[model samples]
Target: MDYASLKQKLQAFERQLDATLAALPSRQWASSSALRIASELYEIGAFKNSGTDRAEYLDYGYAILASHFVAGEVGYQADISREADLRQLIADLSFASHYYMIREYLYYSYNVPESMSWSFGEGRVEIRFSDKSIPRQFFTVYNDQMLGSQSHFRNFNHSAEIIRLLENEPEGVVTPNFETADPLMRAEADLKLAAYFSLIAPDSQIDLGGYSYAQFLNVYRMLLTKALYHRYLARAQDAVGAIYMPEGQLLDGIAGELGISLDIGRRILKDLVFDLDAAANRVDATYFSLMREGEPGGRIVMRPHHFATAEGLVNMLRVIAQRRPQTFLDRVSNEIGRAFVQRVKAAWEAEGFTCLSEVSLRDFDPKLPDIDLLVISCEPTLGYIIHVCELKCPVPPRWAKDQLKVLNKDSVSKAFRQVEVLQRFLRTEAGVQFLARVLPKEGHPHFRDFVVALNHLIITSDNAGMFFGAETTRAINFRTLERLLSRSDGDMALIQHILSTYDEHADEALVTTMVEFQLGSLTVAYEGVTASPLLEFPQGSWRSSPDRQAMVDAFIADGAHPFDVLELHPPDVVVNDHSIRVTADEEVPKK
Candidate 1:
């Protein structure tokens, strides 16, 4: 790619975006917040400060594009930082630019239809919008609480404080009132929430049977929660060893005592309350970059174009993250698992054993109850040796919050359950059916012919602080396993011997039901709103408030037109029919 030419085009795009953001009504906090973030990211000084050379600037821009702009919102930054190459970043930038333009068009393009998707140049860029009606159940149970209006502002403002309160203060002591909060604070909160909604959410047009004021509010709230990041809390001295609230009881306490739902309570837990302590290594690299370094004029020198594309790409990433966050997370998980499993499978196959992936235990039932990788070895002299392997890897840092802690426990429980079911099947009539299909083509062997040894293994990318009760499952590091598999030179006996001696250390604390209630000096403060609030209404005016409804009715009774004049009252002026050149871009000007 011609970096210089691309840079110029990017600058042009930035200018266009700036103009569009500036055109949005000031009351539109989301638009303004997005504009601020975009502008901050595009500052030229930040981009060039990393180095004077063109390549250096490109590298910096590439990092920001991958790490901050595109994946930062949904907390998927580290993946890009470690795995993405320059070429991939460029393609992403192009796609993101196109998506950005389409997003802008969705909001600004006039006379929008029910469903539409369009391309600007040779299908290089595309955007599709299909109207989704709110679930009928949603409307039935929907209260203004779901609208999350004031809640968004409250969370944006007091998330850090809320976390602190949850950690230290008794739950009943803190009662948060998102409504009737400071109007100025509310405005600033609105802008931040708005920024996330407009830029990050996949769908902009939400149909609610008919557009109601409440519907708009609810849609914005949903987007805000999706945009919000959840940071995992651990003890101050030990970041990962003893995670805070493994069972999520603290969140439950906060919910019960504070009257906030568990969902909102969870959001408050990870709200960026304070700046990371200099020594803290727990924060995700992507978050560190976006919050501390990625701004254009700061640590990274980025142009407006880069920021624009990042915004668009983040929305694109959000779609992926939203549809299947697990699969999206497994982007790295699968990579780790596949890399290790591929080696193990090849080695075992070379040793004359059958290795399979995604082994289903159910007799063609639903997609669940499947193993990640299963190895079944049958030797005439030896017995049947079955290795049921499941892989668990750490997600990108920000994504590895309290939710991951819960998910890990659930995964282990499910894996254990599946293994048990498989074990039971092996001794019963089901084992015969399973073996007939999965066994090698040699022949079905008698159950008594071989010694059946079943081993369950959990392979991890990192040293996960998982507690295991005296379970037969072995937790082994992927790197260690990869090394072991590599060195085992087609020796199935050596691998089996090593695994047979593998330690199954069980910790009583490993169960998810175990609760640890220790609040350390988290020492993070919620950064206050810096954006200047501009109210749409006149000072002390209630014109926009509900009280204006009665005043409006009175005014209409006195003199004002009560309805649309074109529909309700005929005008004296009439236009004679006249023909003029008509096209998509031009219409005859009215006199």
Candidate 2:
């Protein structure tokens, strides 16, 4: 058959099934609830049949033995649940569920709670079909026009069969949009299933004994949102794999395809290994509480803010000191030392730089104008320093904005181009500095440590070890870029003349270029660390030769500190030098 003809055949076959359901002379579906019961289990989890070691099929229980399973004594369920098999567990759990179409005397059908079902005489029916997931239709149609899918099966062969079946189905009214009409089907299912399992739920079931349908749905929806978020965090990689589905969009995709939220939806995506998920234990639900009140995303605080400037802003700290320093000096030494290491790890990972070795912070100078980050790239190969990163609760901007900028996942071909385009940027001076502030570290304790420890566990040889490289993006530390550049220092001609746009209004000193040499060059080139005649520049906006010359002369002559001086401190009020304070509060307090 031609393509169109094939589609017709499929439609016709569906109609035949619908017709068969309609024509049963006895017409008993409501009481035979096994079909309804079995249908829902497929949506949530797997089921093993009690009658045999084989798994139960939805077709067998939901359709073939619908009446016997839901109403006429589901013996297989009892047999299975007692001993604990998949089929038995499904039967016991699905007992009161609305998924089945049980046969009363004849025609009525009622839906199980989560999906649209109706009372057909005394029977129940659920949204089910063999060809696809409901998302296939729901997503493709409503995707852009969720409301436009009403005519979905108008031309479908099964539509006619369903019409025939419902025609005989007396208790229920013939309708196509029952699901959209009630909209509570899925929520009801979540609640009902949760409640049923609650009896045996390792911990407990969320209660809904006397709640109204609306009430049950409302509470269940929120709980489901949380639970879905949990699922996303739990297995983000599996979640990410779903992005290619027809129904997948940012926020709506998760609920439409997977019946959940997108925040969790994207997290589940394969390309990522969410450190936030790892930072805390799963059962703790730390993300929920952190995010429940405020916005879902976090603010981007520059490095110096938390460690040096805004001490009060950073909180929720869990500090660890292996040994106690009973004396004041001992205490100060112990705490700051531990804290710096912790900060180093957070900073290292925040920017996505992998530590290739246990490069000691012993070489660091806290008094240096900038915090140091060590990596394999860049000059000064003995070490490269990225400025310290401040922890921005929820997430730092380096992590947050880059994450938000992600459009979607691509396969191998696109991945190659993406890696290629990005490497070019990373190789540049601008890109290297950005890497210092932006990337996240992937493998930990560095390559030196991992390789040495590899034989201890025979780890690097395992297939599982390869999985990490595939799943997670290896980190990009500026130091690593620096090292790469150090090797090719002579060949970096492409980037030599091209300058990157730094925020003109920002302080040159505070603006981290990561590399000491690069930053120093910029300062010398600009003459002053802060922008001159700030309003004069508009996108690399500069003055005419005479005007620029005049401005340069003025800047050179201005002795103490040039420019507005407001740009020197992290904030405008604080000045670069103690002598230029406009206000007492802005001055650094004396120790």
Candidate 3:
């Protein structure tokens, strides 16, 4: 449409979009945090350090056009250094997408309708309001938590720190706005839970139809505990993936997420916090270059791993070691060299065998060093090393050649004839046969009896399908087996029976049954809320703390994005967004 026409249409649409948005269900916005993002551009205005250029105006061009984006990806950038313009662009987007939740939850109310959705340009959000928008059954659950007043929206003092901090952003940002938005934490969960009160969730009987709120909360948390990030579990249900989640697919050219805690990643027993399909779509979209990338003046030079090549992996590992000194402590969160050690160990363990996450090929002639995935299965007759295989997640990293040289120079395959890596190695009968050289990597970890120890140490498994062109093998490491058995398989699915549940991290928390003791008993008017009947959550959930943490971190003053921590209600702490969006004030004074 022409500017005048486009302007006219969008303006009318804006009014409608706003009113309609105010009327839609929380599930809709919760469904695609990116969908409602248009409202920010069309109504609230996004940021761009690039002055007033179309390139910048259109920075969020992709998001404006695309229907949704992964929640975590809202601040995506290709680099973080020397891109004030791009950083501002990110600041603008964050402010608008999470600006402020008018309703946040499906609190029963009169003005609110059954459900609604709004689209500005190609983007749109379909919110399902609480059924009938009745005042009591469900929507009224959190009226006390709604934004204090609409006047709060009048003169939006968008955080300068937020604007300054977002000036230069890099690609694949992974931050959650938790550290800065603390006081308003409960508000965060409210925004997401808003959809629950909306009308999307089916009116099911098992939502403890006649149970007390306390009783219903218990079952609710239990269902959520069972599904969040339960990929194998998700495989069984027809739910959609989350928009903001990182999936099984590896990413290229991205920085580690900001403000996220171990709890944010490891604490999720289930992702039943929001709509499954929308969640899936949001997360699945993370496989591309979205938003303002390579604009003039505003350049972002990302860490090597963000680009995802063999060399990039090496460099990222190096950076990780330089930056995170304590990574050596944990198998899962270790950085760089140690991370690689952990990775190799984990990969080898995926195959069948009793092995440590780390191995020393010194025990055997050929050491399988500097490899991505190693698979092997053992049979007493065939020998201790029955089968051997190696695999890698190929993302076409930029530094592939340099790292390759470092690897080939040492070439464990050469030193130890039996050792092998990649396509050439696994194709051979010896590869299929698996029993190659040995290494001296046993009992490195301080702890004992992890899945890494039980299943992978004994055997190697491969599903060549994991890569573009490869053979067929899938190992049964204790961890992998546990994951498999935890969820429903195709055959057993129809039976509605399960042998056991598989916890992703397999941490003490799951065993502790932390969720069961919390909101397990609370009840809600399932007919009124938009939550999925497929799962449930506890009434007084311990997760509430973290869930609140996730929200409060993002909710800014007057619904504006907190570009930096200095601009927050309580400053002096952190000043970076997920993709490393640091503020000038947070930077050391220039010499």
Candidate 4:
């Protein structure tokens, strides 16, 4: 369907939905007693097989209505009270709208709730049907409009079926209504179901006993939204293994088919992941809290947010489908790079290599950046080999060509600078801890003293010929790695040779990139070293004048001096030689 038609249809659907809302008997639905009774009917329908009698069918209707009333109540309330940011609120509404419309369509297309029963004689006696229509019709129609005609079967199907059944039956005989079946009795039954569902609902706040139908509706809508997103995600995921395109392409196609915008689709996907992160933190917190209290299970009611993140991933294929193939490729470069790393890791492991991915330097020093992948291969001839791979996913080939040489040059410069920073960080105490974290199992015991040869690798989708190679940071095309993997079985020599070339072509200064700032005149404790209070230098700066260092050394050694010399040199303020300032408070205490 064209976008215009799909939009128009959507608008029509919304109008129908509003009518459905207006049709609801709020006075009855909002009644506490009525909600309670409806809940009881739902429980009965859930656990028991009430035969196809009028009373049984009525019970089913009560269950369906009660479920909606409670859902609407919970969802509406949660939505109003949701403490999400503006973006989150927008996402929530989008999902809720999608969910609501889908549900409404399903209800109409399949004649649900209403289809569950056929009332003969205009509500005198209701008869049940196990199969009047299929819910799958809605799924097929939504994804492909031509597959099924949209129709509001409503009570029409039930009425027709009842008419047919009655016409076929003996004229004198009729479906009998249970003697005790009445609105009040059904209400009572519904209340009992409501109470039962309250006890069993995963979320306590959603329990009908304490919360109204409106509030419950809010939560219910969110849950349904999450569920629908998940449904699409699962379907798209199944396509990923079979499709040649990037994962996002598949998701995009699904979204387009569903008439959902790529932007909205992506937002849903992102929100899903964020929600999962939140859920994970909550679970961890719960686990720790319970452990502290010496408790078990925690019996936590999995919140809707916990499930939202997961369902959010369903948007991947639909959202990604909207991008140009090149854009999709560029965005997924990390995924491709990681895949290459995994393959390399596995190949090396088979050939005796240890590899680690996503090594963070922040563990030792909270300020340092992280390494993407670190592969360590021990050779019988060579001592220890550590390969640090930093990936730069280039722009789309077309864009790169159009943008000219400046982009390429900038990329090369940026990459070399990163290498310098990484080399500097590695020489610090933090780098020592980082090495410990990535050390191979066999090398763990001797990691502290292991003599290591480090090789830096820059993996990028860009061709290796695009920029000049650095001594420590050598660019390797992603395709080259793939080809090498395909050709070589387990040859350490081939890999070592490639890296040796990188080492040979690398600048000599890369080896000495890690430097220590030597304070020549300063005497420091082995375990504790502090700079002179008067001197200020940038973090990680190693440059120091020899004369200043000598003066510091003299100051440290002058124990026989009767007085101390204190100077103030703020970072931005420089102190001149032969200058002394004495405050009134420091004039020998006026003695």
Please report, in order, the local distance difference test score of every candidate based on alpha carbons: 0.36, 0.25, 0.26, 0.35
Identify the leading candidate in terms of TM-score.
Answer: 1
Show how many residue pairs clash in every candidate, following the order shown: 13, 65, 130, 44
Among these predictions, the greatest lDDT belongs to 1
Can you write out model 4's per-residue Cα lDDT over 1-591, one digit (the tens) per residue?
444554454455446545544454432233222333332322333223353222223332332232232222321222223334222333322233233324433343232233222222321322232221212111211222111111112212232223233332332232332111222223432332332212122332322222322333333333334232222222323210100123255346535544445655444433222122323333211111000101121111222212222211112221232222454454443444455456545644654467777777765666655776787765332235577777654431211122123134455446666777877666554454455445564542312222345667776543353324223455655544544433344344566565445322322212111111111222111111111111111122111224544554564465422122222211111111112322212232211
Higher-ranked by lDDT: 1 or 4: 1
- TM, every model: 0.32, 0.20, 0.23, 0.29
TM-score of 2: 0.20
Residue range 373-425, candidate 1, lDDT tens digits: 87776633333456777755432122213223423545544555666665555
Candidate 1 global TM-score? 0.32
What candidate 4 gets wrong by more than 4 Å, as runs, is: 1-351, 399-413, 444-450, 469-472, 486-488, 499-591
Question: How many pairs of residues in model 3 come into backbone collision?
Answer: 130
Ranking by TM-score: 1, 4, 3, 2
Q: lDDT by residue for model 3 over 1-591, one digit each (tens)?
A: 234453454345335434532332221333233333332322212212233332223323323223332233333333223355334434444322321222222211112222222223333322333222221112221121122112223343333333233333322242343223222322322332332211112222221112222222333322222222122112223222222223211111111322223333221212212122324444211222212111222111111111111121222223222333254123212222343334445533543333433343433226345333343332111112222323221221112121122123332112222232323433333432222223223421221111111011111111111111111223222223223322222122211111122111111111110011011121111112222111111122222245644554445323532232223333112221212322222352211
lDDT of 2 by residue, 1-591 (tens): 244453454344335444544443223323223222333343223222233222222322223332232233223322212334444534433321111222210111111122212211222212222222111212221121211122222232332332233332222242453323223333433433432211112222222122122332333344343333222222322221101112133236345644545544343321111123322322111111111101124111111101111111111111111111143133233333343345445433443344332222222322222212333222111112222221111111111111222212321223323334433433344433443333234422212111000000000000111111222222222222222223332221211211111111112212211111111112101110111222111222222224645654565465322223323442212111222222213334332
Ranking by lDDT: 1, 4, 3, 2
